[model samples]
Target: MRLRIRPASRLQGAHRVPGDKSLSHRALLFAALAEGTSRLSGWLPAADCEATLRCVRALGIPVERLGPGDLCVHGRGLQGLRAPIAPLDCGGSGTTMRLLMGILAGFPFPSILTGNAQLSRRPMERVAEPLRRMGAEVHTTDGHAPVFVRGGALRGLRYRLPMASAQVKSALLLAGLYAEGPTTVIEPAPSRDHTERLLAAMGATLERDGEGVTVHPGPRLRPLDLHLPGDPSSAAFLLAAAVLIPGSAVRIPGVLLNPTRLGFVEALQAMGAPVAVAVEGEIAGEPVGTLTACAADRLGPLEVSGPLVPRMIDEFPIFAVVATQAEGTTRVRDAAELRVKESDRIAALAAELRRMGARIEEHPDGFTVHGPTALRGAVVHSHGDHRLAMALAVAGLVAEGGTTVEDAGCIGDSFPGFVETLQALGAEVEALEDPPRP
Candidate 1:
């Protein structure tokens, strides 16, 4: 699972990416929990999302396929999800794990949730500790997965989030759907609200007050028909590729522009990249737009801190790759959340980038990059993180020699067809199935 990508002319094209991963997870899960049939189109048919569909189906909800990328979810409604006989394996999806905890807490079943080794390492305590506050019997493998959430009586309580985490916030909100009383969660800053958006679209009553969000229980969730927009996080790699090579212009059509997810686009603009966001329309009350980027001068180091950190959580790795080509230094702090992702991203990014000769330092929370850099080809590992794989691909696009990435397939968990999309835009990539190492 090694990939070789060589430098080419400006990575150029007008392309549409796969559906947003965050939205797809919440959409299907909520659809299964709502009353009647909910039809979903433009779904991301990837490993992680498919895992959600499978696990929910295992919980006794009948989910049928309409097409390759479409699904019809037959929900058992707010109080009707059947408990699975075995453990609920989430594969490598944290969204499935966290949000499911929130959802399962509403049901009165004792269940176990687990995932792959990579996901097993992620912090489940973020959701575990909160759901416990709502009066659900929740436990975890210390701070990691193998979480047992015994669904029973729940009372929604006001929660102040310790970090800027949409998954944690959304989990609390989703669980709130089943509480006899109202549930509210406050974030220090805004995180993605696709959960709130989808919840409202499904006829659930949800309101935002200041930095906190509240949802009332016993609201009937109606059926929904949706066209999910492309994921900007997945599209960030191509946009980064276009910027690294001069004379490149690429248009990404119909991507989600939720304020919670647009921090990456803003960072590129601040770095002087030629970036344009065209409002195409709206999907499920979330802003949908096309993002265009062109090659530009070196990006300057950035200060990624405070409120801006949560909005761009998923894009930080590629942002780090982009930062390597920028002048000066970039410091990213107040994002200790990075440590809880598929891997210790801050440390992994710094280690892998240093392997390619970038001067970077890792901190407990985040990292700093010293750049306006030049990278030579190197053997890099993805640490089984999808974003890491995508970041390495960008590293190859701007490196002196072609870079070889092991575990490139990890990107399929979030961004399926990632290699094909980049190759279609003239990137030189060869997918190789190298022999397994001892």
Candidate 2:
């Protein structure tokens, strides 16, 4: 795909982008697990969430899309799903694979879960090992995808994650749905808690204590009324665009600010991006706010290291590029999780960011990008990573001339309107069909 961008005129106003992707997934899944209808507004109609919707619907949840980005679900209630006639395919969504495995663990029959090639290659052992300990019959290909979940009969226990993973945490918590007693999940390094919050909202007994959280099942869940907030992760791109362009300020309205998920915002602010939280409010227990991203001076090179990596793991590639405009070196570590995200993001980002003239070093876990480089446009590959593709496209916005992204179609998996949204903010972005290869 060819991206043609020139000097962009400044953006001076606010724009509302799409709803939170994380909330969208949880809303659908939690609603499916609840006992009645869940009315949700502001769902992102992107591919990943749709993949979740599809999988749940296969198990008897009536997920209805009411126009663009709005959905109403007829929930199955806890333990209400009948066995699916086929193996549910999540198709590149680990969110569906891991989370659903937990939900299915307590049902009366057997359920099999699978994903597309990329997701299938991801480590399911994170969830499999923990659920195995909980007395749930779970099997994987040594530790990867194609997990088979045998339902009925479970024992809840305390399990601390060896790593910080919302997926893993959510899996154990979901299994706690039908466990004999309280199922405790202690994450030494915390991950996103949208699952916990949404579960609690739906009448699931979930509580947090410091770095740990616990969930208890057998309580009847109230049907949800979901009004999704804006996706901060989605807005991060346009925010970066507005900040990079001099004399620009773009305001994203009503974004979710669940504490564990706000690492990207904190990282950018720490690096000196002029960002502010505005329009603060609460909807269904998740904090909602608007983010103001403005053009600013050079940012100090920073470290996106440590336990925070899992919270903002999906945003690291673009965060790395944004690091390029800052002075000093940006160290991204403990993010070995990136190796399995959609693609091997660490290697993919290091290799493709190099195509755009970024100075960087790579480790098995993560990469360090030494920035303040004058980036130039060149041919780059997405390696089939959605965020990496969009991150590289963002780099093209400031490159001399522009850049061409191979397999740019991957962006559709997450932020579907990424090109259009940035273009509206005065970033000259054009998407072309991938040209013929030699």
Q: Evaluated with TM-score, which candidate comes out highest?
A: 1
lDDT of 2 by residue, 289-333 (tens): 888988878788777677788778778887888888888988887
138-190 per-residue lDDT for model 1 (tens digits): 99998888999987888988999988788898899988988878899988888
Q: Clashes in model 2: which pairs?
A: 34-77
Q: lDDT of candidate 2?
A: 0.82
Model 1: residue 87 alpha-carbon error in angstroms: 0.8
Q: How displaced is residue 395 in candidate 1, in Å?
A: 0.9
lDDT of each: 0.88, 0.82
The list of candidate 1 runs beyond 4 A from truth reads 436-438
Q: Report the Cα lDDT for residue 403, model 1.
A: 88
Error of 2 at 273 (Å): 1.7
